[model samples]
Target: MTDASISHLQVLDWGLLIYDDALKLQEALVSERIAELSPDRLILVEHPPVVTIGRSGSLDDLRESEEAINRKGASVFHVDRGGMATFHGPGQLVAYPIVKLQTKDLRLYLQMLLETVAAVLRSYGLASEFRGRNPGVWAGAAKIASVGVACRRWVTYHGIALNVNADLRWFESINPCGDPDGKVTSMERELGQSVDMAEVKDRFTRAFCRIFGYATPPEVRQRPTERPSWLVLSPSCTESIDRMESVLSWLRLSTVCQSARCPNLGECFARGTATFMILGTICTRTCRFCAVDKGKPDAVDGGEPERIAQAVQLLRLKHAVITSVTRDDLPDGGAEHFVRTVEKVRECCPDVSVEVLVPDFRGSLKALQRICDIRPDVFNHNVETVKRLYPIVRPKARYQRSLGILEYAGKHGLIVKSGIMLGLGETEQEILEAITDLRRTGCSFLTLGQYLAPSKEHFPVSRYVSPAEFEEWAQIARSEGFKKVAAGPLVRSSYRAGEMVCSMRQPLKSYQSKG
Candidate 1:
């Protein structure tokens, strides 16, 4: 049951996603599959109640008015698939396979999809068959699964939806598959019992792999064992490194450069710059992609902000960058601590411009406003990755919440900035979308860097993006209307805080070191 050409398949289980967001992910992956940049991938997810009208569908297919449907807390969309009207909601297993078709015969692909669903149903001791005219799997006279797909350049997307334990009442709103007399049912109804969705997903994955001639897919692609030549860092001056370390130790200060194991640590330290991580070293949230310690963080130190200011003074830093571990344990998310730190830095080094790469402050507008009152040179927050990867990459954070923070700061006349890491299995289209989103929020500065896995225990790096590719991204970001773009293998949120601000020739230029 294997084709020599089909060596591997990747399965991405997105727990729960909005209908539109999942479509964007499919569109992004379709392009990658067409370009042969990525392997075949299956996106598994469940959507909140949504009725999607395909190319052949019309408003007539919907039994309820669009307004009536809205009142029921369901969404409606016109999609580009081959079917008519289809309803997707919780308790339904939706699978979108982004695969490079070996042949252009779409009928064969569609039939395979039906076969996969039928086989999975059979595993539950339910017999299903393909009914007349319509493209779907049926149990007796009732539909158990709906099949529809769209293809681009011989790459396929918009796959099948199987009714495992879905509530059949939602189907009453639409003439399922545009059929006037279609009957829809779920495995729970057919078997006269409830079915475990997790078990159904497992069976479907196995059935899909076996029928499609693919070997068992790995949960995640294995990371490359060796580092690329470009990632090889140049040697730094030991005297400069020792001097900065001595200063940081004397002040009892912490820097993300050391805690996050930033690749630019040696280079930035040699240049007398560091992104000070305040509050405490331990983070309350356990983001899979970060290396910072995660635990119940200690009480905030009242004297820590003064030490950070003293470190800025001793180092003669022109642009002092401040960041902190996510302190969700605090009521204001340590917003007051940020205010105190900024005030102390201003008192100690009036000439030095301040930049705070802060957290989302747990989406508290009042908390963010506290920092905006002080008005640092830059208000930076990392969206970190695409919305599609939120559940797996940084499960504790919300994408819209992060964006809201940036948008709120921008509205208050702050020079907003944000960063994102690459090679976490994200497609180029996704990155471009992120850049556009940032610009819309009036984020003037952007940092695009390669994500390095801190350890095997952390999220694995999907691939090592080449330097040329990174430069190309930088140009694309600038073209998106960003005022300043810092993109490279080693670029970070505060990689070159002073230089980026000075190059802009803004008011912060006065703070640049003359030497």
Candidate 2:
């Protein structure tokens, strides 16, 4: 006989089915054929109505009784997926692939599934990812797709349940995917709109084919080409950055410059300057550009003030910049911690000037008073961007409230400073207006820098500001009555901050001497 031709290998089109009862029947059929099929078959099936319990699932998680489930005319079955219980009903697409893996690695197989689903979701204008330790495509903490599978004799059965336009209310009946507190969400929930089931199925099928190394069917391969740049630090700088970061880790402190994934982290760390993020890493409000984990606040760490002081002392920092996540979750927006931290830094490092970069405290005068009472050497609050971009750029913060905070600090005898990021789709006039607003607030110092996207998942950068433009902006800010201005590509609220503050103080000191 002629040598066996691999070119003659059959390329089977993925079979699609849409019915509630089809899941149980198809799963049983795939499981039965696992050992018998010479070449594994790939089947894509959609569920009409069902609840599934995975290997580690518990019946107690189900709010409805077995009789209640039966009465609803849906069946519940145990699955091999590595999650807890989940509800699948009409309008959800469930894909079951019964195929032998080209590679025997289960992890790689799972990654392929996730990438495939992510590609499909991208086509529909949804941004999603596989969160580490989480077994689904999440648009934050909400689950949009669930994957569960059983592999035996190197053949895979069971698969993923993607929530397209499913009624999410059904998921609330049980602790979805097992955790009682776990929140169940769908594509419709995130997008605030419905998607066509046929379109979803067709797009997903093409994604699966492309991912599995099969030639894409001509009709489904036209993917949108909008690649976002991934912001990452160079590996050569990791050692140097990590050495500085070791100090923060030792003190259990957080830095938004790191946590928010600032693009200039390497340069700052190499220079041995770090922006100390206090009041814990958890933020109260969710902003689109920020990467800080948002949720209910953590309790204030009383010892944090002293610890930060000790770190500043140990690092021999001549000027220390302290900042915090938006702590609206706290009654005082963590202003007390800011005050205490500033005080401790002053006490311990008597020669070190303290600069505080703080939130607006939800426009609370009392909170502003608490921080001002500490008399930080430099009281800096960022306007972040122009008023026009405020809603989209800093959704939870108010531009007026921020300006008020700066003015209040200045009026209270503190050296007030403010900064804004450019390249956020803001116009030059808007920038000039913002500079004028800062001046009206009595801000003595202003810093400006480009807004580089921290992650692809975050907001895209509208443009990058060149060095020459930054210098011109700095000149404009100075002419607009800012006592000192620093604007450049690498400029940040705390960039080369000690030198800048020292330069500003020299002129003030000389003027006082002359007086």
Candidate 3:
């Protein structure tokens, strides 16, 4: 039931205090609220690295001993909350609702806490849900927030802890919330940047007040009247997508743009451009974030190159982007297939610029050299994300190895291009370092796009990066010497590829003429 009878809540933001101190404050507030000495108050605090175990929790839940945790600059506490072990540290926003429980039912109170945080996360476009096993907010396989509460004669304290940007390594030192297999992720990790804790606190206070019937939500934005400018497809694009699907299905050829569930699929196909996944639809590598089907793929289609080239000619396209699922099982990692496709496209649509976005070929010099020898108009590869995130994001793909492929292509006089998705939990410094690494490999063009979480099953989108942040990164990339830059929330590797080739037309023509 809505607490529409409640009028207001006093919110206290206590920044970066020790866990014990906050616990003491919660105790005091709980007493005051029960005595009617204070209003229904909410306390927001960022705790120093500490792990708190609930009433029934055991010391065995702590992966590290008290002495070890103390030495590492964190502390452990036995608390009166209702969950097992949970870690709180810098970058995480912890909320303690020192409110008189409007309902005598404990279940409803806990669900309210979960809803309050879930509502706040949803406002930022992050999907937070509670699976039956975990009585908290989860996004995909990662737990975004935990709810634990206590009641002293129906006055509640110790409300919720939602990770805004916490360091996740600390969660590893304990069987957090009694699940050793459960993974902990933060808002920063999910959204791809460090959000202002103060701002998040304000948003949370507003959201909590609204959920508990204390206040109405203020206007932040209106329902969009138009499509997101970047995602706007031509009026005819839908018909084109239908036509494109029919052709692909008939030929049994695959496109990553389709299989990956890229948001730009309709727009790209409608525009008669596609990033063809030539080898097969099934990807060998199971990236946490990719939506591509993962399993054993079918045998390579020998006639794929001819069929793709014919499709290009039939569409009368000016550019064709060919990418592939990583085929680690192959001897040459599908390098020869790339050669066949490029040659076929050039022979059929000679003027159509062929951009091959290839895998690292298992870091083989021979494979890189083989594709470089064919001399496609533009050679593109994607680093996908910054190095630190590779372990979690692209487990099988090495950051350095991918760069080597792009570097080799550039050295051989091909106009090299590489790109990454922003907000993969990469810091500004890490992103700049990644950009510098790409530039060092002689990559001249870059495509920096927001990483969309293809579905709830995939890695949850950490944050909905604003258009302005994308622009800022684009400027930094150009300043760092990227010749052509495409940075935006809706940009994907093959999205607006025709424009990329068009921008480099003068340089490409001059280079080809010299050759």
Better of 2 and 3 by lDDT: 3
The weakest ten consecutive residues by lDDT in model 2 span 1-10
Index of the highest-TM-score prediction: 1
Over 4 Å off, model 2: 1-240, 270-272, 505-515
Mark the regions of model 1 whose C-alpha exceeds 4 Å error after superposition. 1-210, 213-223, 504-515
Question: By the TM-score metric, which is better: model 1 or model 2?
Answer: 1
Give lDDT tens digits, candidate 2, residues 83-145.
Answer: 778877777877766666656888888888888789988887888878766587876678888
The TM-scores, one per candidate, come to 0.60, 0.53, 0.58
Worst 10 residues of 3 by lDDT: 218-227
For residue 439, give model 2's deviation from the true position in Å.
1.2
Q: Write the per-residue lDDT of candidate 1 for residues 29-72, one digit (tens) a residue.
A: 78667666567888888999999999999899999999999999
Error of 3 at 292 (Å): 0.8
Clashing pairs in 1: none
Better of 2 and 3 by TM-score: 3
Clash counts for the predictions, in order: 0, 2, 4
